[model samples]
Target: MEEYAREPCPWRIVDDCGGAFTMGAIGGGVFQSVKGFRNAPVVSLKDSLLGFRHRLKGSANAVRLRAPQIGGSFAVWGGLFSTIDCGLVRIRGKEDPWNSITSGAMTGAVLAARSGPLAMVGSAMMGGILLALIEGFGILLTRYTTALEPRLALATYSSPDPLAPGHLQVHAR
Candidate 1:
C-alpha cells in the first residue's frame, strides 16, 4: 500500500503527450515568422507575429492529419519486428542476419504499401539491407567491446545471484 501511495500518477505520461502540441505550435510559429522576415526584410514586427499565428494554425492542422500515419507506423513496426524476431529465434535457436533482413523487408513493404505498390518493393529492399547492416553493427559492437573489456560483455551484465536480496552480484570473469 505504501509503495502504491508513493508511486506517481499513471496519467502523468499521457500528460506529456499534450506538451508536444504546445511545442509544435511554438516551433511552427517561430519558423514561419523567421522565414517571412527573411523573404521580406522590411516586414514589421506586427506582421511577423501575425504570420506566426497563421503558421501555428496550419501546424496544428498538419499534426492532426499526420497522427494516423504516425500511430499506424508505430503499431505495424513493433508488431512485425516482435513477431518475426520471435519466429526466427524459435526455429533456429538464434537470430541471424538473413532472418533479420527478410523480416525487416516484409514489414517495410507493408509499411510502404500505404504510399503505393511501387514504393512497397523499394522500401522492402531498403529495409532488408538496412536491417542486416544494423544487425551486423550490433554484432561488431558486442565483439569489440567484449575484446576490449571482457567485463562489459552481455553475460557479465546479468545478475548472478537473484535469490539473495539487497545486493546485486556479477561474476568476476
Candidate 2:
C-alpha cells in the first residue's frame, strides 16, 4: 500500500465524498443555470430587459434548488467508490489503475442496480471506460512530467562569477 493510501477507510470515504460533492454542486449549478436560461420564456422586445432579469432569476433559483441534489448523488457515488477501492486494495494486495477502474465499474453498477440489469451493465461499462481514460491520462501526464525533469535540470542557469551576478549561462545536456 502506498503511504497516502494508509489513511483509514472512513476518512478516505469522507474526503472523496466531500470532493465529489463540491465538483458536482458547482457543475450542476452551471448546468442548471444554462438549462433554466434556455427554457425561460421569450418575451417581446418591449420587455427584453424584464425578460433577461426573469431568466437570470429563474436560473438562479434552479441552481439553488438542484445543485444540492446533484451534490448528494455525487457524494453517495464517491463514498461507495472509495469503499470499494479500499476493499479492492486489501483483497488484491496492490494499488494500481485496475483497482480504480474496477471500483468505478462496481460503484456504477451498484448505483444503477435499482433501475434494471441493462442499466447496471451499461453504467458499469461506462464507469470503467471513464476511469480507464482518467487513469491513462494521469499516467501520460506523470510520464510527461517525469520526462521533463532531466531537461529542466539541464536547462538551469549557472552564474560564471559571484562578482558579476548579472551574467548567467544556460548549461544544456
Best by lDDT: 2
The local distance difference test score of each candidate is 0.61, 0.88
Give candidate 2's whole-model lDDT.
0.88
Give the alpha carbon lDDT tens digit for every residue of 1-173 in model 2. Answer: 12334567778888999999999999999999998887877675588889898888888889999999999999999999999999998899988899999999999999999999999999999999999999999889888988887877765446656577755555755
Once fitted onto the true fold, the runs of candidate 1 whose alpha carbons sit more than 4 angstroms away are 1-46, 109-121, 150-173
Over 4 Å off, model 2: 1-6, 158-169
- TM values, all candidates: 0.50, 0.86
RMSD to the true structure for each prediction, in A, is 12.3, 3.1
Evaluate residue 151 in candidate 1 and report its C-alpha lDDT on the 0 to 100 scale: 56
